[model samples]
Target: MSDVGDCLFCKIIAGEIPSKKVYEDDSTYAFADIQPKAKVHVLIVPKRHYATVAELAQNDPAELSHIVGVAKSIADDAFHGAYRLVFNTGEDAGQSVFHVHAHVLTGEVLAE
Candidate 1:
């Protein structure tokens, strides 16, 4: 997928906006959520813009794997090896942000 010209996540990765970053590499970045939904809420995003998980999955397998791998490490550190990781796929799934990201949420168990 091609980059979105004005995606907020892209801007964040470019240091255009302030974010509490946890991890960063050439292809991905993980950061603390501005409005966290859990005691530990972090968003792991790709440095390159992809509008949705499907897009990322279809177009960039290597980058996607790296992104998830980094997210796992973040989750392990944040929750000490226990946490729930989520991806809001599209608008109907509560994906307010168009940027593709994985949500590592933990601290308190959210009843399934």
Candidate 2:
């Protein structure tokens, strides 16, 4: 797992790396995915780095809830509240970045 010092999402949150920001608050940051999977594919992440969703949930569930709220807001604005929230927990689950994030997919009808 990548540490905060080398985490890509950490850099984006810290403004060390450029991102197409969609929404932000004291605890969360939402930005467009570099490789979008949907018409409106945004990644919502906590400002604090957590290796996985399990870790985040175990440590700070409120922040996880806040991230979901932010994702809902983004989806609501982008596609009338129809969206899919995805959390890839680990490397085997396709979580490329160690920092916990939610993939908000919306703006079109999604596959089941």
**Which 10-residue span in candidate 1 carries the lowest summed lDDT?**
1-10
Candidate 2 has its poorest 10 consecutive residues by lDDT at: 66-75
Residues 1-112, candidate 2: write the lDDT tens digits: 9978999999999999999999988889999999999999999999999999999999999999888888889889999999999999888899999999999999999989
Best by the lDDT measure: 2
Give model 2's TM-score versus the native structure.
0.97
Question: For model 1, how does the per-residue alpha-carbon lDDT over 18-41 read when each residue is reduced to its tens digit?
Answer: 999889888889999999988988
Taking all chains together, each candidate's TM-score versus the true structure is: 0.89, 0.97
Per-residue error (Å), model 1, residue 58: 0.8
Clashes counted in candidate 1 amount to: 0
